[model samples]
Target: LAALLAPGNFIVMGAALLLNGFAVAPTLTAGLAAAERSVVEKRKTEVLAWAISALNLGGALPPAITGYIIDTQGVSVAFVIPLVCMSLSVVMILPYLNIWREKVREIPA
Candidate 1:
């Protein structure tokens, strides 16, 4: 948010994006690992394929949508799409968050 809202500071935005880039790999890996671990061995391959498909679709769609929003409503409104998504994801995940936390705790890190 700070990066997005930073007043004419491209450097801050770049740095923020760079930091965010660092998180993407670990987050995706953990998500896929958890997804695989949650299912039976026979179903693991199917689950992984589905996960990859979703990730691919997710990666593909957002930029075009965001670009359209920016073209139509301008830069200010473009942020709303992600903010709403982030908020909605939080709301949807809150109930299951404790369960995930416990699962993470069980991992032999």
Candidate 2:
């Protein structure tokens, strides 16, 4: 944030964070919704527990891996790794978005 507050960088960083939040919110929400929807009625609690565990694991794994990479390879390369990972996630999720939209449409009138 201090780095972001530096003159011209502030505007750019703010815009990036804004865009990131917009993109992340729906993706994260959909992931949670999908997890909920996928559960059997009787086992919803167990499924939710697994879903939360998976979410935490996903959140933790990248940072740990990235931190290790940064320690060994330097900060710049570590930063690029997330860009690549995010790009891949977007590519993979794009198809699923259409599927999700169809499911939404199919909900009873």
Candidate 3:
């Protein structure tokens, strides 16, 4: 976003945003669905609330951090902030995904 936006090309920015939105929709939906699946009946609301809160915070905080980077660094460089964060997130999630898969298998679907 910052990289494309820096060029001041509205058309490319708009297309990128549109495509990015499409890409993110499934990821966000899957996160929520996984949360729903993982929660217990008694704490469903609380768990969902926490999931939503985390989602909101995750969505909100990166922009501020990126914006700060954009101010200090150049826009192209600022995009590295999100790229690194996302890379770290994938690393962090890999273990949990394996655990979730094992648990799901144990459920005897």
Clashes of each: 0, 0, 0
RMSD in Å for candidate 3, one decimal? 2.8
Candidate 1 local lDDT, 1-109, one digit each (tens): 8646796798988888899999999999989999877666799999999999998998899899899889989988876788897899899989998988776667664
TM-scores of all models? 0.80, 0.64, 0.79
Ranking by lDDT: 1, 3, 2
What digit string (tens of lDDT, one per residue) describes model 2 on residues 40-85? 5687688778878988898989989998999999976865786698
Flag regions of model 2 displaced more than 4 Å: 1-8, 87-109
Preferred candidate (lDDT higher): 1 or 2: 1
For model 3, the superposed segments whose C-alpha errors exceed 4 Å read: 1-6, 106-109
Error of 3 at 85 (Å): 1.3
Worst 10 residues of 2 by lDDT: 1-10
Instruction: List per-prediction Cα lDDT, in the order shown.
Output: 0.86, 0.76, 0.78
Per-residue lDDT tens digits for candidate 3, residues 1-109, read: 5345558777787888888889887988877776666756797788789988998998899889888888888876875776799799899999899878765665433
Among the numbered candidates, top lDDT falls to 1
